[model samples]
Target chain A: MTDLNPSRMAMVPFVSVHDMMRIVNGDGVAETIAAIADRIEADFLRWEQFDKTPRVAAHSEEGVIELMPTSDGERYGFKYVNGHPANMGRGFQTVTAFGVLARVDNGYPILLSEMTVLTALRTAAASVVAARHLAPKDAKVMAMIGNGAQCEFQALAFHHVLGIEEVRLYDIDPAATSKAARNLAETDLRVVSCKTAEDAITGAQIITTCTADKKQATILTDNMVGTGVHLNAIGGDCPGKTELHRDILLRSDIFVEFPPQTRVEGEIQQLDADHPVTELWRVIAGKAEGRTSTSQITLFDSVGFATEDFSALCHVHEAALRTGFYLDLDMLADPDDPRDLFGMVARADT
Target chain B: MTDLNPSRMAMVPFVSVHDMMRIVNGDGVAETIAAIADRIEADFLRWEQFDKTPRVAAHSEEGVIELMPTSDGERYGFKYVNGHPANMGRGFQTVTAFGVLARVDNGYPILLSEMTVLTALRTAAASVVAARHLAPKDAKVMAMIGNGAQCEFQALAFHHVLGIEEVRLYDIDPAATSKAARNLAETDLRVVSCKTAEDAITGAQIITTCTADKKQATILTDNMVGTGVHLNAIGGDCPGKTELHRDILLRSDIFVEFPPQTRVEGEIQQLDADHPVTELWRVIAGKAEGRTSTSQITLFDSVGFATEDFSALCHVHEAALRTGFYLDLDMLADPDDPRDLFGMVARADT
Candidate 1:
């Protein structure tokens, strides 16, 4: 029989921020992104087996806190994340996250890890996964319109996984562009810091707009987006946030992670409720077509979903266990007899 | 300016099972229960200030996992809990939990703690808080049916907070009764091990039913419960799981923590949709009646509300901080510049 004592079943593996960094650096960020992307693909392929729901969110004056939960009948996962756009001025990250993965059979948490860094990696990987099928064939030149926290990961995921040789970066703030250029200085990709959004998308086949504003701003107008390019729009993910003009959404054949959630938080929020967007999982599962024609304007309305977090958590759990980079936290209370919890507390008096 | 480095705002205080026990034992269980009851009462008095919602649950064949979240516009708290009735046979706790408390202003967590032990403390405290208002004056005896993990805490909370001087314990399993009797031998209250449920409620003015079976079990028959006795039904807190008979519910003046939730999960699930049950917060706020006369039967149909967890989290956060009985967990990622997350990870390569 399994030991039902505090010494045996009370500990849960926890990967701290420091340990997460170690795991990423040890395995290489590019490699981690590739592995996570593969896991996301595998999960997407079997999407019908999982239970899904729109995230539960508590919106406040300052920001919103959300709990995104999903389960695959065998494993359950959830991420607690917050987005406070004004937090950056107060010396806090605009977004911070942590997540837990548990066994569905017993509901005991198996792994807990910091997800702020992992989210960036998975977001970029998810974009690349969409691009691999939706972007034009042999696409090599990409435009990144947000030179901020997620820019480098998007640039690297494309450079390493999809073999994009050059990246055109642009930001409203020139300092952010300089920072991205300086960070990518060591990489082999030809990094060009452009002066404007138009300059950034010049001759690019993939345009990724990931700005950090929390308002409706038309970063990509209909005229600016040409045919035969994949637009990965990820920044406008809240109720009142949008990055593309309504004309652009009307012009492109949009694909989304989940329709019910995307209709509220994705760029499609500006379009009619019945605007007819394709579910990305259908394309991934080979049930629908992707990039049907070379001249098609394919746009991936990318709002990060819970399944991607589940995949990232699965990857982090395995990597942490293999590399021994996690702490066993005494997060659960296991009494010798489950009915004697009071006895456990009373006996501690000794 | 506030420091934006990873070392500054990234750490959250984590109170483990060992640390929680230390804090509880250090303060004394009776004192801790009293303090928690005070906090719960205080929060209940101002219940309108909170953003309340029924717990979001994911049920499976083996068990159910739930997330209970609430905020008072300034602070946010949520608990992750699971209930697996067959877990005891598999050498696991029937229920286990953990919770997080965060600052709503910035959406950053301030505390994370194991709540298996704390839940016992708060559940007992909440029961006492209810009994204080609903139980007949000068009631000194409580009949505790199904003496399990929560029996001793209930006994102690009644003994210390509600002036109950004696407790009658009875369970289908004699071993569970003996465990409760043995655990309570050190207390000042009189503990009696009864042969049956009828014998247990012989002279008791308050009755608490908290069995573990996930089915309709008539622990309290309509004829067995006399007039003027307050019933605290907690075990039957999920769909299709009910304790008292429907006839018993029709005769009692039902008071619930949250009516919308209790209508689905509490013992009142057996009743009609618009059963005219009273909200407990109204009584606490002095806006509704509790027990009108000595012959009135008052039932507290508690499915456990999110506000109770929020109050318990507040108490634990304060106590943990006061005693310094917690570990600083590097849970959040705070880069030197919020947008320079990639730079932070890149520099960690060194």
Candidate 2:
């Protein structure tokens, strides 16, 4: 065999955090979120075509690491993400992710990308997509509790996709609120730094609770929330971790992504195993109702799903290729003689 | 946040295919196999400490892609691998893999390495580790039925770890046999290329079956096997895939990695659900017997477990850090303030 000169087939296109940030900033954060949201909505319509599996997670004392994999027959995608709220206190991001998309026919990875920035974008996009159906019509303000990594993205996505003009930010750490407030000031959306969660949600038709830390911590109580509010609950994602009070869950019309996972990880984990919740995809696909009554509270229990990541990955793969915002990573071994891997390695020495 | 200058912490050490070959050729195949075997043995001894899960697999008509994840409390590791026999006909590898090793405490990936070469080495090491206990004590001559990518690695591993002096190789494809024979010729061990499986196993104490691309095809029947021989069945992983006939499995004392997973994917898939197979860890841990009698036929139903990959990754993580045969990938977003993720991305525009 000829000496192993690695070819293009061996190189997977890798979009690092730098390029991911570039893709977000260059495309304009709101435009990127809207594009990804469109993909998410489109994929949601073809949900049955994809193989969906709940993320496999390893939970330790410090945090949890998860592998979320999904495939759409033609392509396969998976995200390696970690959630450690403690990480933030120690100068590490609370959540970080990377993903790979491979061709299902050959099982060769074609794209590798940092999903940190992209996940933030996707998470924000998912909320806006859900709110497009569930939020109170004429919703002008979004109350974003727990102003951290996802806060500004959520504000921008709402501004682009849902026509929300103002965002109210609140966090247990006032500094996090200031950081989020400062970032949102860069965008056209009016940013308000609230003193408390209750203050943030006041007069807001869409209240998004994304607080981190403390299992079973009720950031929003039944009395704190009024009627006709759409709640996008993205935190309290793991088992034994929940953010809402039980009374609030009983009053709301809940919607979830994959019941089995949502029951264990979402706010409904506080409720019964058989608590009725609408499938978000069904609502998006026009198979189920999203919001029917004017005075009804609709809650989107967003624990984050594989399909959302898969959708974002599909978008990034195409964008990276089109814009040349990726590096070729020599991640696979493609020998001239497929059966001569050892010979290829041996020849490499020469 | 300062304009996103990715720090060292943001970088993950990546061992690409080229560096993987350099590491393999730099360390020598036999020696590397032995070193990784030692790590596998050490990890197996503390087997109970690991959080073991059967690989999460997405099976398509063309092939299958699997994610194998395992954690040992402090550290986490996972491998992404795919198997498409048809890929070989299209000039792609039948199996390609890559893996990541991360700190469980902070949920940060420390190493990313091309696992195709490492997997070949680890697979061989695992077989040799099991054979050390189960193979005939005086085993010197070995027969490898499939002279494919793994054949040369298997020969070198056996030569270094088990002191095997000679190897007999055979493949349905004559060129594969010649390639394996040529690769083995470079080493001190004697190499014999044969046209048929029966001719290859003549007078051999250890018989290794590593053929691919078939479902339930019996490469080794009961009549071909002799008493007091060890069979390293490395192929036939995944459902509906088997190399040995039922009669051969009935006679041999079957040993497996993980029983629940093995019962579904290993040769034991052909056996009853209750078919008793000794866990290989017990034998290594001295809690169970290996080969009891001289005439006993020992068969290791190797489906390739996650711990084996985790052990290999741990080895690679250390080797890469030591030798610097790796690239530092800007895979993670390490913002100065964890809550300022949006600020970090926005500032990168400047």
Query: In candidate 1, residue A153 scores what lDDT?
Result: 95
C-alpha DockQ of every model: 0.80, 0.83
Off by over 4 Å in 1: A1-5, B1-5
Alpha-carbon error at B318 in model 2, in Å?
A: 1.2
lDDT, residue A197, model 1? 96
What does candidate 2's lDDT look like per residue over A172-214, in tens digits? 9998898888887867888889998888998899999887775
lDDT of 1 at B335: 82
Any runs in candidate 2 off by more than 4 Å, and if so which? A1-3, B1-3
Q: What is the interface RMSD of each candidate, in Å?
A: 1.1, 1.1
Question: Could you tell me how far off, in angstroms, the CA of residue A76 lies in candidate 1 after the best superposition?
Answer: 0.4
Please list the C-alpha lDDT of all candidates, in the order they appear. 0.92, 0.92
How big is the positional error of residue B154 in model 1, measured in Å on the Cα after superposition?
0.5
Task: Tell me the TM-score of model 2.
Answer: 0.98
